[model samples]
Target: MRAAIIHGPQDVRVEDVPDPAMLRPSDAVVRVEASCVCGSDLWRYRGIRPVAHPVRMGHEFVGVVEEVGAEVTRVSPGDFVIAPFAFSCGECVHCRNGVQTSCVRGGGWAGTDADGLPVDGGQGERVRVPLADGTLVAVPGAPGDALLPGLLALSDVMGTGHHAAVRGGVREGSVVAVVGDGAVGLCAILAARRLGAARVVAFSSHAPRQELARRFGADDVIAARGDEGVAALGELLGAEGADVVIEAVGTQGAMEQAVAAARPGGNVGYVGVPNGITALPVKQMFNRNVSLLGGVAPVRAYIDELLPEVLAGTLDPGPVFDLTLPLADVARAYEAMDRREAIKVMLRG
Candidate 1:
């Protein structure tokens, strides 16, 4: 099998790796069909996030199940499925509470499996998926070629975007503002519309990103940043801030802008992986009665509901992929994303 391995910053390669097998009765082996490069993957590619050892990369995928462990009764060998980025035991306390992102027994692509075995990640030709019953969602039929990208989006980006809206407590006819125009943030714009937001505001300076945000349902586009940007948002909302704010960027500037753009007692749903050491003005937040609540997105919890929308053609989140490349040219794809030349790169195996 061939996999995408990152040897160091800006160095991604497609090389042969040992084939995966079902090591436990709860496991399954999936033949990769479609996988995309996520914004999080760029954190390591740009050297902002360290990679001490060469390891597999990529966490969003839709594939075909080639083999399954003895205990995997829900799916069979020939099933097509979408594998969530996180692996969780369906029976955990956190999972039962609709917060599978913090499940006690499961971990993301970076953790151990239900059987106490390490899980093989996405970004490969074939990989072993542990906790099959919990992580893999079977599609009723093979999706058409055109629906591939949308189906793939359900695995991570789209789901994460929806999580932001849910966490932000978006209500029908509410005014919502989104900070950050990355893939997830753009999807949040779409999710806000789906959630029935009356007005959606997006803050972005890039032309390409801002255009996409408008297409997704943003009623107003603010091109400024910093204090000017905050004032622009307030003006757009008739001198009042938004009812809910979504912070998809983890930087101090982004966080501050999100808080400043929300009305008193409003919420900020943030899912960007924080770089650690973020400064927050607790005094301002306390005075404004603002609430901040969000972290790693519980993407797995939203897949079932979002998948049907994708299948129904009501939502098309596939435009997030501005570039596509074969697995062999993955290094160039990584560079394209790192340099901001591509919004999101789709890698086909």
Candidate 2:
């Protein structure tokens, strides 16, 4: 099978890899129908994060089950499914608490499978999914290209954006602000509006994304960065900053800016993969009475809650994919996104 591999920074390739099989009783082999390049994937592509060894790439995917392990009863070979970015046992304490990302037996994608074998990346024709009953969510039917993108978003970006909004405590008439203009950020704006936010302020430096942000439900758009952005957000919300702030860029500067743009007692729901900024100003947070909420999104937990909206056509996140490419042209997909020519790149297998 052909799959995507990241040899190093800015070097993504489509190459033949060994096919995956159901190596464990909890595993399933999925024929990937669709997957997308996530903002987090750029962390390694831009060398912001190290890719020391050649490894499979991609995580978000919606596919059809091709085979299932002996113990996998939740889904069958013909079922359509969405595989979140990570695999979890679902029986762990953390999973039970709705944090499957921290499930005791869970692990991320692009590495080895549960049986210690090479796993095909989501950007491939097929993939080996461990914890099938826990990580793979079965959709009612096999959706065509039109509905696939929205369902695919449930695997990661959309779910993560929803998680950010949920953590930020968005409610009716709430003033919401989102930092970052990437796919997750735009989805955050949509999620905030869906959560009943009266107004949503989006931070976007790029013109195209700024337009998309507005389309995604952002009431205000700020093209500033750093202190200028904080000030802009502050100016919009008056004495108190936004009621809830969503930080979708995982950088120290973005984190600080997010904290600065929130009102006293405001909540910041951050779901960006933490690239740095490990230290927090406890003093500042304590004095301002701000609450920071976020982590690897429990996608499994929210899929059920969000799926209905997607199925009903009430929530269409498919527009976030500004560029679509075949799996064979995945390198170009990465390059396009790296150059900011695309808001999000979807890959068809």
By lDDT, who's the top model here? 2
Q: What TM-scores do the predictions have?
A: 0.97, 0.97
Clashes of each: 0, 0
Write model 1 residue lDDT over 107-200, tens digit each, in one string: 7773366456766668889878877888788988888878888888888888888888988999798899999999999999999999999999
What residue pairs are clashing in model 1?
none
Give the CA lDDT, 0 to 100, for residue 55 in model 1: 80
Show the colliding residue pairs in model 2.
none
Instruction: Score residue 10 of candidate 2 by CA lDDT.
Output: 87
lDDT of 2 by residue, 1-349 (tens): 9999999998999999888876889889999999989888888899988998888899999999999999999989999999988888899899999999888888888887555676667999999898999989899976777898899989998989999999889999999999989999999988999999999999998999999899999989999988999888778788957989899988888888888888899999999878888876667778998899998898888898898899889998889998889999999999999999999999998
TM-score for candidate 1, please give it: 0.97
Cα deviation of 206, candidate 1, in Å: 1.2
